[model samples]
Target: MIRILFTMIAIGALTSAQAQTIESGSHSTTGYIKSDGTIENSSHSTVGYIKNDGTIENRSHSTIGYIKSNGTIENSSHSTVGYVKSDGTVENSSHSTIGYIKNDGTVENSSHSTIGYARGVKKEWAAVVYFFFKF
Candidate 1:
């Protein structure tokens, strides 16, 4: 009986640990960019933000990178990661295109795959943007 109880406790501890790890993973935010360059989530939460100088911040308000006026996006370490074009198409640092956000609010990939959409508007337009990850 003691052995069975110990096993159960071990299982419970493992399950709890796994849950914590999953909860700490990257979180998705559905938000709009304010005219002042702040990113707010649907719940009105400030998931991230943009600065006048084009610096971007994460939910924790940590400086993640910058977005230049020319639409070039760079990381905090100053590495080119992607670009946001005038036509609404987003491209990687290598200039390889991934998707575009249409005027009607549709986000489509190179293959024309609809990934997501944006709604509403502000003095500064908001877009359904994606971040490029480098392995």
Candidate 2:
């Protein structure tokens, strides 16, 4: 009975996960960022995932990258790829300012041109999905 209860709790947790909509700058639905770490397209196809320990996995579950607790981004080989600053500034490995994820969910390029939005999504996750990878 204890085991069954635990299983039910786990299932409940997974089922309770929420998904935040991702949108283009024009506000058209583009994709989603699920609370359980699933990244899905607007059509509801799984595109990628962000694991609890910051490991990023493709749809096939292959390790692709990571987002460290300190906001450091890394590639599959564990090489530093970029960073997401607390203020929403995004920088490349060379520390060049590459983009920004605003508090309002607006995503902007180095030139400050609006590219997209991921409202209600974590900034680090938004940076990885929007700037580091195409998914």
Best by TM-score: 2
Model 1 lDDT, full chain set: 0.59
Per-residue C-alpha lDDT of model 2 across residues 47-86, encoded as one tens digit per residue: 9999999999999999999999999999999999999999
RMSD of each: 13.9, 4.1
Give the whole-model CA lDDT for all candidates, comma-separated.
0.59, 0.94
Q: Where does the lowest 10-residue lDDT sum fall in candidate 1?
A: 18-27
Look at candidate 1 and give me any clashing residue pairs: none
Query: Model 1, 4-33: lDDT tens per residue?
Result: 999999998775433100000123335455
Model 1 stretches astray by more than 4 angstroms: 1-29, 120-128, 132-135
The TM-score obtained by model 2 is 0.87
